[model samples]
Target: MGIITDIVLPVSLAFIMISIGLTLTLGDFRRVAAQPRDFLIGAVSQIIVLPLVAFALVTAWRVEPVLAVGVMIIAAAPGGVTSNLLTLFARGDVALSVSLTAITSLLSVVTVPLIVVTAHQHFVAGSGGEVAGDLTVTGAVLKIFVIVTVPVLAGLAVRHTMPGFALRFEPLARRISAVLFVLVMVGAIYAERANIGSYFAQAGAITLTLNIAMMAIAFYGAAWLGMRRPQRIAIALECGLQNGTLAIAVAASLFHETLYAIPAAIYSLMMFGTALAFVFLVTRGRPAAV
Candidate 1:
């Protein structure tokens, strides 16, 4: 577990970020700036609303302090690559999905630390205070930048410099990212096997509730805002499918505590089943592509 946390987790996360980048183009960023409303809604739902809702759930559920922090950390993470894939499967706006994901991934380098620090102060400080010591705002930002931003930028650079190669490699990169994500989740669960059942008992219901509520909010909220069906689907997924791998990596690498990573590991496992159901429900009898 120690070696996996120290070595495998970070490397796996970097690969995932790189895969995200390989799918990106400057146009994805530009598209967000050009048509800001839908993008803003998706980003706000993810970056701001999701964490607030999770915090509310944490308070209402009276979750264990460490597990509460874990939930907050997962909420603070950007939308996962899985969201983009799911959006495509659901015949949603893939372009919007990519734009939301790319923008939020960059923004999370700042937002994650801010949210995590606040959660630490609120939840962990009154406790033993050791977890707070293990995590500092500067260290969190640096880890995010190095593991998330740098790899993404490198992949984007590769795409720009060798367009044909990037095009050919994107599918394989995504496949590798998916495999690495599973391995990371497994490592997180194995590391906490002694308390896995207890952790799940504490976190499973809350995480599932959060995931469902977020998707409902994003989908109906977008509809109320007069967004198209595709945009609604994209927002729903972006809001729901958080980057659990990143959350777990941050928890394990920074806090060195299996307890802190438990919610993310459980959420990651739960999301695949829920997301698949979401895809089927949303895409039933609909066109295959947007």
Candidate 2:
């Protein structure tokens, strides 16, 4: 059952990626060229600043070395598709949000493994080998490319080859993806059920603090970058949010380490409540998007 659950996640994620590709085009990226500063800010914050923030939070919170690496992996993850929905709700620039998601997702094939390996090495050195066993550099890289990049490319290929068929399948794809995402959450919870009490006791505060901190970093980072209101909201949503479900899948399937999966599991639970509150605060009294 655990092995089957592992297979389901990447398959569902592939469908979700295909749906995104079907809805996007090169023109979306071209639009970013007209707003170079916003594009640069969003990219840099995601690729550089956010991961650093995660590392700092882990250290400051005194998270266990293994769990700290988990936090960094989640941090290194791309902006989720859900951010586009949240941006739409916040009356943000949907195009910018979509563009950011697209770019970040493309970049994660390089960045995620880099972040994971770097964190693994750092924690191993710092903790005198108390880190979660290192995921082999070669195997980790191969799995990331195969598991993440392959599905994204396959999705894109389907979109390119059969636009009509792609459109027809997208809604169903989304519904399936949504259901699978929920199931992943449920499975994660069930898998962690026995350890829930201790997991929370050991790392709940760290997880909560990191969640709030990153969200705040994203919000303030966007504003500080002088992004317009809508773009700021979009960047905030993207920066703070992540695909924790995917992280859980990586931990469970790719890494086969349930203990290492707990941080993402905790994050999956925390983000919904926090992100909803953020959408409320940012969008509550604002006029609706046109």
Q: Write the per-residue lDDT of candidate 2 for residues 59-104, one digit (tens) a residue.
A: 8877677778878877888877788888888888888888888777
| Predicted structure 1, TM vs. truth | 0.96
User: What is candidate 2's TM-score against the reference?
Assistant: 0.91
**Best by the TM-score measure:** 1
The segments of candidate 2 whose C-alpha lies over 4 angstroms from its true place after superposition are: 130-134
**What is the alpha-carbon lDDT for the whole of candidate 1?**
0.88
Residue 173 in model 2: lDDT: 71
Return the TM-score for each candidate structure. Answer: 0.96, 0.91
* Tens digits of per-residue lDDT for model 1, 133-156: 556788889978988899888888
In model 2, pairs of residues that clash are none
Distance from true location, Cα of 248 in model 2, Å = 1.6
